[model samples]
Target: MWYLISYVEEALKYIEANYSEAVTIQDLANWLGLERTYLYRLFNSMVGMSPQAYLLDVRIRQACTLLTHSDLTITNIARSVGYEDSLYFSRLFRRKKGQTPSQYRLTHQSPESNS
Candidate 1:
């Protein structure tokens, strides 16, 4: 059980480092030298979410950071966060965040000075 837990942890670390790229379950399983279905079951049972779901969650969280801290345009931000299509990214952001990216940025942006 502890071995499986460590395996999942390693998988999560890899996912965090490569979430901006097209990381897939098969890729992870191949890298871990485990069967795809077995890895998926272990990961889902331990993490309470599938690998793909976790990847999307990570990507959206990164997008949130870029939205709040950067002045990059929405399209550019979307691309920077591994989204090739800003419209699709906006839709996904709305679904996950309950607001469009632009709306989120506007509401969360730091106050500007009149100077």
Candidate 2:
């Protein structure tokens, strides 16, 4: 169990480091030194999904925080979160957030925005 915890921690760190790049399951599995199938099992066992899902969730969560707090443009937000194409980023954000990125930002202004 501890080994798995360490594995998850390492994997998460790698994701954070490389989330800006074009990451794939095979690449992430290789980076973590785990067989793809076993990695999938371990990730699913611990997090209820594969690493890809976790990475996307992390990105979306980060985007949500950025949206509420920052004045960056939508495309900039998308790029900051590893998306080169705002269209795809917007689609992904909407899929996860039920609103476009702009709408999310507009609706979720933070204290900074008030100032």
Candidate 3:
């Protein structure tokens, strides 16, 4: 169990570091030397979400950071977060954050960034 937990942790770290790249469950399993299905099960059990879900979460969270802290354009920010389709990214961002990225930045941007 602990060993599985460690694998999940490593998977989480990989996701965090590579969130701006197109990563897949198969890639994670290959990196961990585990079967793809097994990695999915273990990740779901350990993290309460599938690897894909977790990846999206990380991407959106990173997008949120970029939105709040930078003056990058929306399309650039979308690509920066590993979303090649700005429209899809905006739709997903709306689903996760209850607003478009622009709205989020408007509401959450730091005072210094507001200048």
Candidate 4:
């Protein structure tokens, strides 16, 4: 049981470190030396989400930080978050954040960054 938890933790770390890349569940499974279905089940059981869901969550969270703090264009932000298609990123961001990336930035941008 403890060993399984450790694997899940390692999976989380891997996603955090490589969320900027085009990572997939198959890649994660290969890295962890587990079958794809097994990794998915373990990750979902431990983290309450599938590996792909967690990856998208991480990417969206990172995008939120970039949007609020940097002047990067929407396209750049999407790419920076591992999304090659800006339109798809926008749709996902909207679904997760309840707003478009631009709107999120407008509302969440730090006052200091306005200087």
Candidate 5:
């Protein structure tokens, strides 16, 4: 119980630290010194999603922040968040956020900004 919690915490930290890179469940399990199947089951049981889903969520969340706060091009932003294909990134972003990344940035821009 508590052991699983500790593993989950460590896994989350690793995910956050390496979300910009290409991370996989096997990598995470290897880092934690656990079997991939066990880690996947434990993570899914606790986090309510697969490790891949969690990774995507983290990447998308970071993309949202970069989209709103930085002037980086969408392609660059996508790459920065571990996505190699900007079009796939945009499609995933729209599916998750209900709007294109550009639209999200436009709507979320600061009220005082004139851009």
Candidate 6:
């Protein structure tokens, strides 16, 4: 892979690895062995978003999966998806999906949701 692309990929991998914990640009940059500003620009240039935004997108994606695939409570699900604050998770979930987590789960997944 190209150097910038590889750095971006490493940033993505770090996000996946530590998604359940608090993450920061410094942490991710250190992991990728790049300076924070460089990594930030690299991600934005390649992916159209900063590292933090990308991580939020990933978190929401995992939350969507858990919301549909598991029977966990919303708060627990939030933690599993890496948001420590349940209310903040709910806000982010709603912002991305336009519905509360409970509502999205009921509407998106049914026994027939397999279809």
Most lDDT-accurate candidate: 4
Ordering by TM-score: 4, 3, 5, 6, 1, 2
- True-structure RMSD, every candidate: 2.3, 1.7, 1.2, 0.9, 1.8, 2.6
Q: Which 10 consecutive positions of candidate 5 have the poorest summed lDDT?
A: 106-115
Score every model by TM-score: 0.88, 0.88, 0.93, 0.96, 0.90, 0.89
lDDT of 3 by residue, 37-113 (tens): 99999999889999999999999999999998889999999999898899999999999999999999999998776
lDDT of each: 0.87, 0.87, 0.92, 0.94, 0.91, 0.87
How far does residue 98 in candidate 1 sit from its true spot (Å)?
0.8
Better of 4 and 5 by TM-score: 4
Best by TM-score: 4
Residue 60 CA displacement from its true place in model 3, Å = 0.7
Q: Candidate 2: list runs displaced more than 4 Å.
A: none
User: What clash count does candidate 2 reach?
Assistant: 0
Positional deviation of residue 107's Cα in model 6 after best superposition, in angstroms? 0.5
Q: RMSD in angstroms, candidate 5?
A: 1.8
Q: List candidate 3 segments past 4 Å from native.
A: none
User: Candidate 1: which stretches are off by over 4 Å?
Assistant: 112-115
Model 5 segments beyond 4 Å from truth? Answer: 111-115
Using TM-score as the yardstick, the better of models 3 and 4 is 4
Candidate 3: residue pairs that collide = none
Better of 2 and 4 by TM-score: 4
Model 1 over residues 19-106: C-alpha lDDT tens digits? 7776787898899899989988999999999987888899999988878777888998888777889999999999999999989998
lDDT string for model 4 (17-71, tens) is 9999988889999999999999999999989999999999999999999998888
* Model 6 TM-score on a 0 to 1 scale: 0.89
Put down candidate 5 lDDT per residue, 1-115, tens digits, no spaces: 7999999999999999999987788999999999999989999999999888999999999998888778888999999999899999999999999999999989886644345
